[model samples]
Target: MTEPARDTIHCARFLPHPPAAVWRALTDPELHARWWAAGDVKPLVGHRFTLDMGSFGSQPCEVTAVEDERLLAYRFAERTLDTTLTWRLEPEGTGTRLFLTHSGFDLDSPMGRQAYEGMGRGWPHVLERLDAALGEAA
Candidate 1:
């Protein structure tokens, strides 16, 4: 029998910037669009927004938690996939270590399985884009 894939995607990187800067990149809409999806992301809880996901259309999201420059969590694709994306930041030697956990994927469904696999491949590239965006902000 074949083993099933894990139902979560996790990524982490040490960015050469302060947590505040990284937090801005994650929250500020313009900077966020330059890195990830285009959305009016803010560091406020209980805010609802939508992201332009290219061909996937607008995906609904809701701010679930915020902790200044340390953490941000949200419900992504709330209308459909209902996944939670959490970003954790920690200070590290004058820079910041960023960690991401995209969980709540239902591996039994085809859409969920596909998204899990696709996002697993795509997040690394997105993080690289984040790096470039932060570089431009410098």
Candidate 2:
């Protein structure tokens, strides 16, 4: 029997900042570029943009949902993986708890499996970068 394909990557982190600060890091294109890729990311529904993923080229994206500093969801790499990336932020004492979910990977395909594995390792580093960026800003 073939092994089941993994279809989602979830990561969470607690940052020593308010939700608004964390949200800005997630939405601001310049701040985003510091952590992950460069993109015209905004917390506005129906916005469309592309992220420069270095050697992976540019990935087309569209904002599917937005809830101010609470949540942001977008369709990432629409022409490629067609996955959905969601970010959720919740107030926790003096800081915010940030959660990321990247879903809809078609693990049956070789590309999907490869991406899942690569991103599984890459996402943590990306989050660490985000933390470092926030530290610099703070």
Candidate 3:
């Protein structure tokens, strides 16, 4: 018998900012904290960091892959949730198209299911906050 496929959260947002600007928002700790969680995220592979996820406490993360301002993939939540978050930035017209893939949800577990559902609903708002943060920077 085979197990079921895991759930993955996919989100895309077109920000009216250059890829470099969006990339800074994703990589720079202060800019990232303004939009998302506070973390020492860097565009360097194999770097380890912790994101302060507010009420959910801090989550450990590790940079698994990075490609300059183009792509970044990281292991999120480490041993507990054990998920991967990949961010892809593509230049689009006058702005940037940002794609987010949050995968490795073990839906069989209650914690995983809840997190999958919660984050699925929460990502849009998070992206909106990112846009607002970019606007402030602009």
Better of 1 and 3 by lDDT: 3
| lDDT tens per residue, model 3, 6-62 | 589989999999999999999999999999999999999999999999999999999
All candidates: TM-score: 0.95, 0.94, 0.95
lDDT of 1 by residue, 34-134 (tens): 98889988889999999999999999999999999999999999868999999999999989999999999998999999999999999999999999999
lDDT (Cα) of model 1: 0.94
Q: Provide the overall lDDT of each model, using Cα atoms, as 2-decimal numbers.
A: 0.94, 0.92, 0.95
Steric clashes per prediction: 0, 0, 0
RMSD of each: 3.1, 3.3, 2.9
The candidate, 2 or 3, that scores higher on TM-score is: 3
lDDT of 3: 0.95
Predicted structure with the largest lDDT when compared to the true one: 3
In model 1, how large is the Cα lDDT of residue 78? 88
After aligning candidate 1 to the native by TM-score, how far in Å is the CA of 114 from where it should be?
A: 0.2
Error of 2 at 111 (Å): 0.6
